[model samples]
Target: MAELLVAGGGIGGLAVALAAAGRGYRVTVLERRDAFTELGAGIQLAPNAFRALDRLGVGEQVRERAVFIDELRLMDGTTDEVINTMSLGTAYRERFGNPYAVVHRTDLYQPLLDACRRTPGVELCTGAAVTGYEQDADRVTAVLANGERVGGDALVGADGIHSAVRAQMIRDGEPLVSGHTIYRSVIPMDRVPEHLRSNAVTLWAGPGWHFVHYPISGGREFNLAVTKDDGAREAVTGRPTPADHVLAQFPEIGPKAGLLLRLGEQWKSWVLCDRDPVPGWTDGRVVLTGDAAHPMLQYAAQGACMALEGAVHLGSVLDCDAGDLPQRLIDHNYALAPRTARAQQVARAMGREVYHPAGVAAKERNAEIGSLSQAELHGKVAWLHHGTP
Candidate 1:
């Protein structure tokens, strides 16, 4: 069997390993952490994500832990008016071949980790950070933080936006700080007033800011993610903030939305960041995947989905028996580049055009989105949710 080394054991890395193992390659995943675990609060999984998860054999497990949402709502934060909403009902499932759902990061991650553990010839290593990589014409090797070297037929850099493997391969400086600060709070459902709790994913868009809330953790917890275009010059991640400070940032939102924001405690903030998509990520027998290859803003809610897609696509195109690893890796990057770039662009656009417009711009955004008929709304998302991109 062929050997593959995957750096980073987050959602993407684990998926890549499972996908390759299914394709008859022996995969070893090198995770830097002390144990195989997932952090973060919640993630929205579109139908495209399910398609990729199903391909990796964990779709059902994820579904068991996910909250199948009723709809996605965009609202005028200041006026308390509904802008647009997309229904994710039976029609949507039938149209897209999958349900739209939200899951705690662990809900999705655990299933992938479990699948990796169950698969034969798949090894999961913790605390084995891949520092860099070296490749000859015949094979590639992962240089570990501990100074140990592991050789494999090919290498995948799924180590996230700050990937060490990517540093060696692409030499792109650092991830682009999006200049937007996002505050997040995950509170138990019981703490939330019944009026604020909902089965739908709702976003209240204000001037240069937005607030999104949804049920996650199988309805046991509510996830709150609110962003501010505060011109934060440096990149920050998961830094705790005073709840009062967080609430003060979005004064334009109506009282009702303001009340909802106030329910959040233990708030943490992250300065959103992503990278400009490059034409290629392949370096001989080594290549980049997930955030290492293409990281995008969370506005599209497709970051995890794109990572899943890339891993599955790579696995499908890599033939162990062909003895053509380099070209196959290059082709994998090429095939996914256009779609990934488009998604990145869409996410960036959504932040500026849809989520943070103000004054007349906000009014026009409301009128335009509110004017969209349900069919028109579904038609607009069909390209993305239909799973091609």
Candidate 2:
């Protein structure tokens, strides 16, 4: 059997491993952390992500732990007025062939790790930070920080936005930081107060700031994410941030949204960053997937979803028995680049015009969102939700 070596055993890497193993390839995943874990709050998985999960055979597990959201509610942050609402209930499932849901990042990661563990041909190795790679005609060798070398048929760079493999392959500089910082937390559902609790995703948009809260942990907890234009460009994650600091960023926010923001404690902050999509991400027996290939701002909420899509496509296209593996990788790059690039560009646009518009632009954005009928709203995202490529 052919062997596939993957760097960075996060969601994309593990999903790729599972997909390859299912196709009769022996897969090994190298993770830098001491243990496999995910840090963050909740993640919204649209139907598109679910389709990829279904193909990887973990859809049911993901669904079991997810909160099936009923609606997506948008409100004016300064006035607490409802701007627009879209349904994500049964009708959405019927249209997209999969339900829209949210899950805690850890909850989602656990099942993928468990599934990888149970698979016969998948191996997970921690404390193995992949430093670089070298590929010859027959095989590719991954060099780890500890100086250990592992050889396999191909090497996948799933090491995230600051990927070492990407550094070597594309030679891109540091990721571009968007002068915005995100404050996030997950609190018990009961702590969210009675009137605020709902099976929906609520987004409050204001001038230069936005707040999103949704149910996660199977409806037992609420994930709160607030983004603000703090004008700080340093890229940092999981850093301790004061609740007062977060509150100060949204002084103009209305009462209800203000209350929800105050409910958060032990908040962590991450500076948002992304890279401009490139023309290609594959070189010989080495390739890139997920954030390493196309990191995007969180406005669209499709980073992980796109990664999942790319993983399935990469696995399906790679054939060890084929005489032209390099060309096959090139084909994978060609198939993914256009779609992921569009997503990346769209996300940046959404962050500016939709989430953080100011004054007149904010009113126009609200009017545009409020004007959308149910069918129109669905139609706007149809290509994204229903697309397989």
Candidate 3:
């Protein structure tokens, strides 16, 4: 079995490590943090994502930690009108052959990390920051911050949006701020009012901003994500303001949503960033995955899905041609790049529509989305929610 080195122990890195180890390869993952930690908020595992998890042998565990929803509710924040509703429970199962669920980021991370730790062929080393790498025709040598050098038959850059590997590839580029900032928070399920705690992924769209909320952990709590275009606003001055601060920014939201926002604690702000897709991700035996390869806008919710797909495709390619590892890496990049590029474009377009609609167009768009039949909504996201690729 070829020895592989994976950088960054985030979701993508951990998934790749588990997938590769399950295939009987010797794998070592170097994570910069002191321990395994998951930052960020809720993650929606669409059907395609679930399929990937199933393949990695943690599907049931993921389901147990997530909330299953039947529909996606769309509303107008300004007028408090129901714009559209899409059936997710049956529609997702029929379209993608799996269920749609929302999971806490930590809940998703722990299972994958635990699997990797228990795997026979996997070695995880924390506090080892990768400084650089040197590759000859035969192998790649990763340089650690502590001046230690580790050799591997191949390297997988499963690092995150600010990947060190990606920096080495496209040395001239950086993640471009998408001019949108999201205010995120999570509240315990019991804290939310009974009626507002529907088992649905609810979204309220308005001019220049949108609010989304959904139950996670089997309805144990709600994850709220509110986004707005950062137009002419000044730099964010202080720490994440309370939910009341968010509601005050836009008093136009529905009373229930605004009330919920005011009640949320530990509010935080994240400036969205993305990069244009590149044509290639492989240089000899080293390759990029997830946000490193395609940093996408959050509108499509396919960022994690794309990472999962990349892990599966990369593992399949390597397993298929263990003898020709370099060629296999190239083929793997080719197979994965187009799908990621398409998803990146779609995510950016969705961001434009959802975050910057003009004048009356916002209300019309909201109404149209709200009125969408379950079938139409399913068809619209078939490329993403369905495992067609």
Q: Which candidate wins on lDDT?
A: 1
Candidate models: Cα lDDT each: 0.92, 0.91, 0.81
Q: How do the residues 5-68 of candidate 2 rate in per-residue lDDT, one tens digit apiece? A: 9999999999999888987889999999999998888998989999999988899999999999
Show how many residue pairs clash in every candidate, following the order shown: 0, 0, 4
Per-prediction CA RMSD (Å): 1.0, 1.0, 2.1
Off-target runs (Cα >4 Å) in candidate 2 are 320-322
- Cα misplacement distance, residue 112 of candidate 2 (Å): 0.6
Give the C-alpha miss distance for residue 332 in model 3, angstroms.
Answer: 1.2
Candidate 1 per-residue lDDT over residues 313-373, each given as its tens digit:
9998776554788888888888889989999999999999999999898888988999998
Model 2 Cα displacement at 303 (Å)?
0.8
List residue ranges in candidate 3 displaced over 4 A: 232-239, 320-323
State the lDDT at 119 in candidate 1: 95
Q: What CA RMSD would candidate 3 show?
A: 2.1
Residues 102-199, model 3: lDDT tens digits: 88888888888888888989999999888778898878988889999999988998788888888897774667777777888888889987877788
